[model samples]
Target: MFGNICTLYYTRRKLIFDFLKPGNQCRQLVPEATVDVQRRQRKMTSPDDESRSFFAQTELDSLKGKKAKLARTGTHSHVFKATMDSRGNAQVAVKLVDLRSRGEYIERFMPRELAIIPRLDHVNIVAAYAIHRTPEYVAIVEEYASGGDLLNYIRTRPERYLQEQEAKPIFRQLMDAIIYLERLHIVHRDIKCENIFLDSNLRVKLGDFGFARELRPGVDSNTHCGSRPYAAIELLSGRTYRGNGVDIWSAGVVLYVILTSYFPFGSSKDEVPAIIKRQRSQSIHFSQRLSGEVRSLILGMLHPDPKKRLYSRRILAHPWLAETPHRT
Candidate 1:
C-alpha cells in the first residue's frame, strides 16, 4: 500500500471541475482591465511572437491586492483571479495558485509539476505563463476560464445525460491533450471532473497539475494519488501501475459521470473503497443511454487490469470516436 506520509495533502485537496468547449486553443491571457503596460511588457511584433515573461512578484503582489477574487481553495493551495496585460487582446482571466499550506512532501512534488506545466501547449490543457516563488508562498500563473468546471457544467445542463454531440468533442480534445502529454513522458496523476476547465467559447482545458508528474522511461509511479471515485483499480488498491492506464481509467470514470451525472461504481464516500474491491468480479452497469461504441471504449478504458486498459492508439482507432464528428 502507498504510505500515509502524504495523506494530509490528500485530505486538503479540494478538487473542482469545469464547463464550456472550443476547438481553438484556449490561451488568451490578457486581463480584464488595462494592465499597466510598463510591467515587463514584451513587444508583440507578430501573431507568432513568443510570450513575454509575466510581471515580477512585486508587481503581482500589488495587483493581487486590488480586486482580489478568490476562486478556489484546495488542501494546500488557493486560486486567485488575476490578470496580465497581453498586448491589446481582450483581458482574459488568469489563475494564481497559492501553494503555501501544502505538506512538505507534497511541496517536493511541486517543482516537477511546475516544470511540466509550462512545457505543455495544448488546446485542451491549461497553459502556465509564469511562476512566482516567495518565502511566504509559491504561485503559478495560468490561463483562467470564464465558464465553470466539469461538475458544474454537467449539473447545470438541462438533463442528466449530455447528448453525444456535447460530450464527444470535449472528450476528443481531452484525449488529444492526454496523448500529447503521454508523448512528453508526463502523467496527470489526478484526472477528474474538477481538473477539467472550460473557456468562454465552450472549449475544454484540463488543469490542476499539483498532483501531476513526469515519468522516467519505462517507470511506473509508486505514488498512489487521485480522486477516489475516478481512481483506477491499481491506485485504489495501492499498487504500482502504468500512469497512462491509470489516467485513462480515471478519464473513463469522468466520461461515465458526465454521461449519467452519477458514478457507475460507488456513489457515496463510504462506497468508494468497495467499488475497487468489486472491480475484479462485478461487471459495470452501463447506462442504457450509452451507444455500443462509446460503451466499448469506456469498458476498455475501465478494464481492471492496467495492461489491458485502453491506450491512445486503440482509443483513437475506436470506431465511435473515429467517426464521431465534433458538431459542437
Candidate 2:
C-alpha cells in the first residue's frame, strides 16, 4: 500500500540509492562514522567481484553460453546456478526476474530489491557482482553457496534438525547479518530459512531481499509482505507495523524452525488464519528438546506485542546465544 505511493513520488533508482545518502530523510538514522567504517570494512572484506562496483556490467553473451541449472524459484524470480568462467570452476547464482509479468511484485518490489542488493556488502550477506536489465528480464549475478540454503540443508538431514551446538553458530551469523541490516535501517521482511544460505563450511549467508525496504523514523510499513508462516502477527492481521519488529518476529520463526525442524503455528500455508489466531492468543508450544534459555529468547522475540518484541540487538545479547550447547 505504501509502496505504490512511493513509486508514484520517487523513481525506483532514487528510492534505492537515497537509502543512506546525505539529505535523505533517514540519513541521520545511521551515523556518518558508521557508514565510513562500513565502507572501509567492505573494501577489506568484500570479495573481488563485489569490490569492483555495485553495478558491474556483465556481458549477456557470457551468461547465454554457460550451462545453468535451476537452483530455486520465488514468487517473482528464478535463481539459477551457472559457471562464470571456463572449466566450470567460478560458480555464480543468477536470479532472473521476468519484467513483463503483471505480478504486483514486479511493479512495486523488484526495483527496490535490485537496487538494494548491490549496495549491501556484509560478510553474512550474499554478494551481488552484477545486474543485467532488459525489457524482458533482469538478471542478478550473485555469490554461490555450495552448501545450498538452510531449508534444503535441514530438510535433507537424517535427523531433520540441527543439534543445539550445530545450530548456535549458524544462528549467530544470521543474527549478525540482521544486526548489520538493522544498523542500516534496512529491514529484510523475508527472513526465513529458505533465504538463509550456507557455504561449503556451512557458514551462514543471508540472501533474498525481495521483500526488503528502508524504514524512516515514525513511519510505518503497510505492505503485508513475506512468507505467511514467518510473518509477524501484525502484518498477518493487516496492521501498520514497524519494519524492525516484523523482521525480529520472522527471525524468531526461523530460529524456531531450525531448532525444531517444524513450523511453530500450523503445518501448511492454508492454515495462516489459524496461525494468526494462535499467535494472538499466545498459544505457542515449544519442543521439549529446546533448552530453557533458547525458549525464553524465542518467546521474547515472538512476543505478541510489537513494542515488547526483542530486537536484533537485544536478541544478540540474550544468554541463549552465548551459552555453550550441551550434548543430550
Displacement of the residue 73 alpha carbon in candidate 1, Å: 1.6
Summarize candidate 1's per-residue lDDT along 1-328 as a digit string, tens digits. Answer: 1011110111111212110111222222233323333332235566433222222223243333233355776766656565433233322333433343457535677777766776787768876654545344455656678786888888888895587768888788778878888999788978888989888887888998877888867787778777787878888788887658878888898888888887767754746567877676546887677899888988888889888888887887898789655333
Q: lDDT at 179 for candidate 1?
A: 88
C-alpha-based local distance difference test score of model 2: 0.70
Q: For this target, which candidate reaches the highest TM-score against the unseen true structure?
A: 2
Top lDDT prediction, candidate number: 2
Regions of model 1 farther than 4 Å from truth: 1-66, 83-105, 271-273, 325-328
Q: For candidate 2, give the lDDT of residue 99.
A: 73
Residue 71: error of model 2 in Å? 1.7
Report every candidate's CA lDDT. Answer: 0.65, 0.70
**Per-residue lDDT for 178-213 in model 2, tens only?**
888888888899899989999998878899899898
Candidate 1 at residue 244, lDDT?
Answer: 81
